[model samples]
Target: MIPVTRELVTGIKLTNYKDFIVEHLEDCPKEDKLSRLKHIWSMPKFGQLPKKPTKLKLLEHTRAYLLYLVSTTIFVDASQRSTLISYLQLLRDLDEAGKYAWGAVALAFLYRSLSKVADRESHFSGLATLL
Candidate 1:
């Protein structure tokens, strides 16, 4: 472990900027993080969004970059830390279905897009293979 003054930073040592960003999701304000994530995911593609986004694409290459922020974070160990855990849990729980019907919408959009793409592009026939 790299020794600092007070806190003992665990996990793999950061050798670059991407490593630092990936390892520090708990440093930012939860609301700000969530707001940024939601803002990025707010795009509405109707049935045409084969692979769009749920919030503003903070990274040009990654659609749900905030998901990286969230996914990289772990709250199960710190179950009593803050309300952010609750929100994260809810978001996690939104796996199958939830209050926000966004998943359902996205699924339908994805199926439509995939069907259309497979029909037009023979090379992309296996929709799952494209992923």
Candidate 2:
């Protein structure tokens, strides 16, 4: 087996760190978590059920899954949540005045294009069925 070097490890982490941050930000929106997450706290018994597939279901499914994952896993403890809140604030409060790499801009454009492909206008494989 090939030996691992410090440079290799550091480069791998540096290359993917922004992606990790962006993914976390996308997965958990603070405002929505604050509002809907409390429902779990109040009830203390929420169940997960299978979802029905639909033509325009991709975006909605993504949202619901993100909410469920966030509520079920993150912010379950008050003390840990405070630390998480500080780090999230740092991401939100980026130094826009200074020059910085904006990877999310490229991701946003990519997401828009992929969403267009999912639209009925693109005709996914030139096939269409009306409900």
**lDDT (0-100) at residue 119 of candidate 2?**
80
Per-model TM values vs. the true structure: 0.20, 0.22
lDDT of 1: 0.31
Model 2 C-alpha lDDT per residue in residues 1-131, reported as the tens digit of each score: 12222111111213333344344333333343332233333222223322664533443344344434433332222222222222232233233211222233223334554466678444222112110
lDDT of 1 by residue, 1-131 (tens): 21123322123432343323333322333243332223222223121334654443223223222233332232111222222222232332233213443333333434665676678842322224223
- Steric clashes per prediction: 6, 0
Instruction: Please estimate how well model 2 matches the true structure, expressed as its whole-model Cα lDDT.
Output: 0.31
Name the lDDT value of residue 73 in candidate 1. 34
In terms of TM-score, the best-performing candidate is 2
